[model samples]
Target: MEDFVYFFSFQDPNVAMVVAGITLLSISAAMVGTFTFLDKKALLGDAISHAVLPGVCLAFMFAGSKNPYWIVLGAFITGAISTYAIEWISNSTKLKEDTVIAAVLSVFFGIGILLLTQLQQTGDAALSGLDHFLFGNAISIVYEDLMVYGILALLVIICILVFYKEFKLIIFNPSFAESVGLPVKRLKLLFNTLLVMAVVTGIQAIGVVLMAALLITPPAAARFWSNRLHVILMLAVLFAVLSGIAGAFISFAVPHMPTGPWVVMAISFIAFASFFFAGKKGILSKWYNQRNYQQKIHRDHILKSLFQALEKNSKTLEKDEIMEYFPGKEKLTRTYISKLEQENKIELEGEKLKLTPSGLVEAKRVVRLHRLWELYLAQYLNLAPDHVHDMAEKMEHLLTPELEAKLDASLDYPTQDPHHSKIPRDNDL
Candidate 1:
């Protein structure tokens, strides 16, 4: 905990500034990333990240130094060109999107590597830190580099805020937006430009290789936690910021470690957690809900068996006879019966199993729904009476009150089902 306190204490202004710069870059990338993820253009971010490498190397060669302006300009140019080429290839050829992206990524990265190798062979002192762009040296980002990143981050944030509604419309229904004269094409171009700008800004702090994670994973992870567009954007920004901070701190604490991979690792950790723990859509929650629903079905089926036994024999069913209905599911049936009894839905008197009044009403309701559905399918859907019973057996438990009402109205209040069984009346059991 002492290490944690020291990390946040701002004992060194350089550490504080590096953290701030990482936070800014992360927020910007995450905001743009959310739109890309929603639009199913996540691979485009990866393409841009790799494709910007040639531009950075060219900028260094032209400027003869590690100048921010030259690097950013070159990056923007290459990134934009890569995006246009991807679109053009996709439209003009039969190649799939993944194929186009992979092609562009490999070509551009190869060129960048070639240029870097040539520069290294020259033994130029100005190109000393050029290799750092492959991984990242977040702690080495000076104040000047931070200023450039900060300005770019600000521009990205402003653009997103101003065009929030338009972007959302384009993502969800581009054809409709175009029909409404919203300039969908121009909006896409502008969005792509912003994405490129985001990639360029992080080239130094996060690097080209792992920078795609900054622009993809946070937003992808955030999506599991929200459906609202605004909420998703906010959550994505929060996740990105957390990852950036953690990555920067780890780089600080552990000497010589690259910050980009650490940042990706942090973002992935959050994403994995969200997949398993977030409410409503999470895997664990889904499993729990499914288990509970199955338990409910089992209890209802038990009550149904008791009602059927009483209908046939005019007496309670023996526990052993009820267990026979479940065959190999004796343990599950036993637990279900115990739970039903605990809930006062069923009674166990000696060896006899009987439903309480509440259980009888519920069982009748389930049976009534099943028979009503069978009749509806047989008469209205033109399904054979023999085929309708099996279908209704599955549909009965899932019918909602509104659906039941619709079915009742459609069937015109039938008195007897296709199987010749009397349909239970509202007050009859």
Candidate 2:
């Protein structure tokens, strides 16, 4: 608890630097990633992250030390190459984008590993922590390291803000954007540059392997909560910041644990929670809506069945007779009947069931819709009367009052269905 408090207090400059740097990196990755996700180019992030490893190695060779500028330039160059190669292969050949990305990611990453191993053999003290780039050690980020990657992250954020509309246009409808003279090709190139820089910024803190999570997972999870691009971008940034802070704190508190994996783990948990809990699109929401829909269907079926019985004898229905209407679904029918009675749609006198006045009106409305739809289908769709009944059975519960009026007017009042049964109305009730 003390460690957690101290981590947030910023009394220790190193902890503050690492935490602040991570926050900036998160914002950059999330902003760029939202478009990458919308463009269906999520794998581009993964490919660029892996491809930067070779650049890191090449940078070390050129500087003879881990110089931040050389390393970033190298990573960005390699990442840019990987991005363009993916596009070229996809456009020039029959190979899919995923296949090209996979190929580029593997080759570049493997070359990086080979070069890094050679550097390790030299036993230069500067080359000692190069492996940390694969998985991050956030605690190792100092003010200087922060300045190097942090400024790049800030640049990415600025670029995203400046070109937000163009990015949206290209992601959602590039052809339309081009028609409107939006310089789509140039914008794509620029967006790709920002994407590479975002990956580059995170490699030192979040690391190469898991930086893709910081890039894509926040936006992917945010999509569940919103439809608007701007709202989604804000949510993605918020999610990324929270997850980055959590991982950074864990790394600060725990010994020998890298920040990148913990961040990925934190983000993964968040993604799962959003999947099951977000409003409208979540698993729980969908399940609850479906359950309510099913219950409503059962209620409507019971009401219509009781109305049909009333038409037959103009008398109350005994429990056994009502249950007999749905032999295999006796349990369901009984439950729906009890619910309808509580709602005052029906009255239960001992074991007999009778429709209340309101219930009679509702039941008639349901029947009216069923008959009207059947008439329309039989007359206009040329479906046989027998064929129309089954279709109308499903439509009765779904048709709105406005739709019912429209159907009534369109069918010229539809006094009788094709089967010659009278279509009951509120006045008739």
Candidate 3:
């Protein structure tokens, strides 16, 4: 508890600096990553992240230490080169983008690993914390590191905000952007530069290996909760900030844990939760909605069956006769019956069941919709009456009142379906 309080209090200058740097990096990475994700260039971020490792190694060897300026410059140059390589290889060959990204990632990362191994063999004293870049040590972010990374992060964020519309156009509709006299190629190049810079800023705090997760996961999780681009960006930033701070706090409390893995873990958890529990798009929500839809269909089927029987001069049905309609689904049928009774849509007098007035009104609408659709299919689509029944059965429960009206108008408000049965109207009920 004390550790939590002290860590977040920003009371210490070092803690305050770490939080500021990480917050800036998170904002920039999330903003860039949201567009990258929408454009389906996620693997490109992964490739660029791994490709920057060799640059980190080369910078360390040349400078004899981890100078933030040298590291950022080298990392940005190599990351940009990797981005170009991916684009060139993809456009020049028959290879897919993922294949090109995978190849570049493997080759550049392999060279980086080899160079890093050689640097370690040299036994340079300045190499004390060099390995921290692989899996980040956010605790090691000094003033110099913060200055370089923070400034670059701010630049990336500002550019994203300034060119938001252009970026959106290029990402979602590049051909349209070009048609409107927008420099699609230049905007793409600029966005790619900012992408590399965003990844470069995180190489120290979030690490090369796990930085892609920090870039991609927040936006992915945010997407489940929103459809608007701006709202998604804001949510992604919120998620990134939470996970980034949680990772930093874990690093502060733990003896030697890397902040990058923890940050990835935190963000991944958010993604997993979003996948299962987010509204409208989540697994649980979808299941609930599907269940409700199925139940409504079943209830409609029962009501329709009762109404059809009433039309044939049988006002009520024995409960056993109704169960016979749903062979193996007696229990579920009973549940639906109970629900309808509760809603006053149906009445159960002893073992006999019949629709109430409100239920008859609903039943008439359902039957009308089914017959209307069947007539529409038979007349306009030239489908046989037999073929239309099955399709109408599925679509009967899905049409809204407005759609039903439109369908009726399109069909000229017919009185009979393709089968020549009278389509029940409200007066008939």
Best by lDDT: 3
By lDDT, the better pick of 1 and 3 is: 3
Give candidates' CA RMSD values in order: 1.8, 1.8, 0.9
Model 1: C-alpha RMSD to truth? 1.8
Cα lDDT over the full model 3: 0.94
lDDT of each: 0.88, 0.91, 0.94
| Sequence-dependent TM-score of model 1 | 0.95
- Residue 352 in model 3: lDDT: 92
Each candidate structure's TM-score, on Cα atoms with residue i matched to residue i, is: 0.95, 0.95, 0.99
lDDT of 1 by residue, 1-429 (tens): 665677789898888888888988998999999999999999999999999889999999899999988988998999999999999999999999999999988999899889989989999888888888888778888888889888998899899999999999999999999999999989999999999999988998899999999998988888888899899899999999999999888888888888889998999999999999888788998999988888777777898788777668655888889888999999999998888889888898897888888888888878778889899888778998899977887788888889888887888877788988877765875
Poorly placed runs, candidate 2 (over 4 Å) = none
Q: Which candidate gets the maximum TM-score versus the true structure?
A: 3
Local accuracy of candidate 2 as per-residue lDDT tens digits, 1-429: 999999999999898898889999999999999999999999999999999999999999999887889989999999999998899999999988889889999999999899989999998987878888999878888878899999999999999999998899988888999999999889999999999999999998899889999999999999999999999999999999999999999999998889999999989888888899999899998999988988887788778888988888765888898778778988888888888988999998898899999999999998889899999999899998889988998888887788889989999997789999999978884
- The full ranking of all candidates by lDDT, starting with the best, is 3, 2, 1
